[model samples]
Target chain A: MFRHIVLLAWVAEATEEQKAAVEAGLKELPGVIPELLRYEIGPDAGVSPGNFDFAVVADFASVEDYMVYRDHPTHLGVIADVIRPILANRVAAQYSF
Target chain B: MFRHIVLLAWVAEATEEQKAAVEAGLKELPGVIPELLRYEIGPDAGVSPGNFDFAVVADFASVEDYMVYRDHPTHLGVIADVIRPILANRVAAQYSF
Candidate 1:
């Protein structure tokens, strides 16, 4: 399986509602996107401090499937409308296991 | 369970031998540390370009178990003797799921 992990830091001024909207947007994708095998998103529990505020871990059957999810209109719309507006920093990693 | 994720970037000068050693060292822990419920580590597939080079996803029964792994002598030794020497940047996040 291909694992795509994204760590996101929201801007300091971002409201709780905005963050919730982003998480909610992410939670909606697996149900609608066929290429997404599994999706998980959540807030950092602060057990390991001084890092990004939110994280997403998704699985795909292959890199091509991951790309389909990546460029899908629904995913792109969430990135543009909900995420990009409040995103401060992002670091991503993809690997097969 | 508590999931602890760590993303690492080896210094540009780090050699392949050093990277391999780091991964090998990480792989040893699950056998020795009972607190580590699961561990997965790998180099980035480069599909999500322009980010850290490696990532680690580990799971524990609770935050307390994670702390035990975090501060374990063997783990600390690996960090100091292997990882920290070649490390460039790191971003970490922990959450319960």
Candidate 2:
């Protein structure tokens, strides 16, 4: 099994409208792919002292399954229309067990 | 080896003062414990379209090592003075291979 964590940071002054649009875009992802075993996203709370804006956690059966999700049209569309516009930086890490 | 991911979300409107204080607390963590193999903290970008604010990724040689970090006095002090007051939500997951 493979576990992937994708970390995202947005501009500090991002507007409410932009944050809403971003959340809407994310909600549309699960329906676009079957490879996601577990997917979750939420805002960072007081757990760590950092500047990150958001996070997504996903689990796939294998790297191949993850690849399918990565290439899906809906995923790409979000990147183009939603994610890239507001994001300042991103980090991703994948591991297998 | 064990990989642990801690997901944190803060109030979107967290003040600059709060953010700075939190970051200071996190910066002081590594010196208090030697078991942390790899510790990285950052904000989430626009990768997955979720609301998480920040994330910390750490690797430990064993679960016991993680426990040491968890129980360290300095770590606990930070949680009380820096983390608990400013954080709204937090999530953590652990896996071994």
Candidate 3:
């Protein structure tokens, strides 16, 4: 199995209302992307010492499957219309097991 | 190799000043924790639709190493002192290859 994990940080100054709106937009993505085998998103717990604000974890059968999800048009639309506006920075890592 | 990935989301209402302070506390962890083989933390890009704010990716020789890092005292101090206060929610995943 291959996992594509993304860590995202948002502009900490965003209001609660803005956060909720952005979260709602994000919640709409899983159904639109067929390649996603398992997808999850949520806020950080008090576990690590970092400025990160949110995270996305998705599982794919392989790297190629992950790439398809990464490049999907609907996925791109979400990035442009919703994610980009509120985010301050982001990072990703892919691993296989 | 085993990978420990953590997805963190912070309270959206945090200020820029608060974000910086939290980040500084996080940046101090690597040196204190010896088991972390490859640790990378960053904000999310506008790639995926999600309200998440931060991400952490760490590689270990094995799952045991990851557990050690997870339960370490210095690590917990950072969590309690810096991470818990700012975060809203969190998730984690472990994989091997």
Candidate 3 structure quality by residue, lDDT tens digits, B1-97: 6666766677978766766666676667788877888776655543446535666777789767888988988788878977788889775655554
Interface RMSD values for all candidates: 1.1, 9.7, 8.7
lDDT, residue B73, model 2: 90
The reply for model 2, stretches above 4 Å from the true place, is: B1-97
- Enumerate the candidates' DockQ scores in order: 0.77, 0.05, 0.06
Give the TM-score (vs. native) of candidate 3. 0.52
Which residue ranges in model 1 land beyond 4 Å of their true spot?
A: none
Model 3, runs deviating above 4 Å: A1-69, A72-97
lDDT by residue for model 2 (A1-97), tens: 5656866778877787886787688777887787888776655433445635666667789878888888888888888898888888776656554
Candidate with best DockQ:
1
DockQ of 3: 0.06
Model 1 lDDT tens row, B8-41? 9989999999999999999999988999887878
Model 3 Cα displacement at B8 (Å)?
A: 1.0
Docking level for model 2: incorrect
lDDT values of the candidates? 0.90, 0.71, 0.70
Q: What RMSD does model 1 have?
A: 1.1
Give Cα distance to truth, residue A65, candidate 3, Å.
14
Candidate 1 lDDT for residue A59: 84
- Model 2 RMSD in Å is 11.7
Better candidate number, 1 or 3, judged by TM-score:
1
